[model samples]
Target: MPFGGKARWGVRSTVALLAAITGLFLAPATVPATAASAKQSSAAKALAGKYVPVMMIRKQGENLCDTKVEQYQVMTVDALFGNPDVRLMRNNGSSKSTLIKQAPTIDDVRNRGEEAYIDLPGDPLGDTCVYSKDFTRMKNEGEAPVAVYAHIAREKGHSGIALQYWFYWYFNQFN
Candidate 1:
């Protein structure tokens, strides 16, 4: 009775047949590794022992809603992990802010040979800031700040190769 037609196969059956065919062609196969796959595997093997931790802070010229915030000086992994000169300070406010005295550079992240951590601050309205790293720039331009971290992570066995697409907007006026 569906579609008010006399067709031999129903809509559901046609859709299922098409979906199964699509899945068969789209799923990854283990046999016959391509050159790109080989390269990714090699890179993953090379990055099996390093890790990096990063914290995001307000860059100069950003609005801070008139809140009193302390600026930290730039710090390296050695200065933060090896030396005892700097200490982490925590605030008792509702935000429970952690004061970081320095932000790590992309190069600092790449040169790290051990485990790492990343800390992104929460926005003023309580929305959390999400951090992601991609290699699109490196693939196209041979380099990018975030790609350094992604490559290192791949080299250290911390993550695997993946393709991602991202859309960014300058402002979200509608929330």
Candidate 2:
């Protein structure tokens, strides 16, 4: 017996024990059902009845384009789904665009606009929720400008809101 039968058996037994112990530590954790439900309820409440912008117009700083207008219109996730609950947010050089009356395809966006800007909701006391499409899906689809939206929401038992970026599109074209 190479290393003696007893010694080999002892080593194997030790390895088996270590593997079992490791598996216990690596097992998936489970959240309490009550806690999970509470969290879901809070998220639902936060998202209820909010209006998010569907179209955006961003000012061209230095990039050259053919359009005489300084700003270009681009469609957003809110515009595509027509979600009335989440409100559209804008920054200093940004605003909702009246040009884009409906959801646009990737080619349509690329042909007319440079970029679309969607202002993320900012809450000093709460958190924000942002959503976007998975990168893998985007890559598989093609090169396009994509838009995502986030919600400023409060977690269950928490005072501050959570920022959640929701995935909406597979591809968005710019340039």
Candidate 3:
């Protein structure tokens, strides 16, 4: 279920939003290592073109006593840049070499900050949505204040930005 339409923005509430986010128990994150130039190129190649997210992928409890996940359904590979009318790549200096035809709706965004936090739908831990890194940063209208797209490595191999202290070694392992 992709979130349709872009929310009307430009209200200019940086200070207010910051306070609200903090009061809500949401904390900001640090920037990720790995130079911007390298990440930009690589992330673009991996995400801007193709990305998809699944609701569940056979979950398993870390301990033997935990229960196992049963649902593993998938949704359409929705575009994550922005609405069709808005152009996000042009703002980021990536005018060509794209794989997404239409930008994904708000719900389609899987976040693109190095150490920022994006409030995706579902109960935190981001509801397990996966998309391209490039598209995650791709902005629609000057990027949202919450869309503070940066790069982070979450300790070890965790290659995604987040608002909280994501336990890198625990669940974000690529191996």
Q: Top lDDT: which candidate number?
A: 2
* Regions of model 2 farther than 4 Å from truth: 1-50, 56-64, 67-141, 153-175
By the TM-score metric, which is better: model 1 or model 2?
A: 2
Q: How much is 19 displaced in model 3, in angstroms?
A: 11
**What ordering of candidates by lDDT runs from best to worst?**
2, 1, 3
lDDT of 3 at 147: 18
Write candidate 1's Cα lDDT for 1-175 as tens digits: 0011122332111000111112112325556767765565444433321222233434323332222331221211232232233333344455564544335544444433333333333232433212111112122343221211122212244454332222222122234
Clashing pairs in 3: 47-132, 79-104, 80-104, 113-150, 114-150, 114-151, 114-152, 116-162, 117-163
lDDT of each residue in 16-37, candidate 3, tens digit only = 1111122122232443334654
Candidate 2 lDDT over 1-175, as tens digits, reads 0011122223211001111112112323374346655565444333421322233334344422323432222213324333222232222355544334233443334434344433222332222211222322223354223333344444456565544444343223322
In model 3, where is the ten-residue run with the lowest total lDDT? 11-20
Model 2 TM-score relative to the real fold:
0.21
Residue 99 displacement in candidate 1 (angstroms): 10
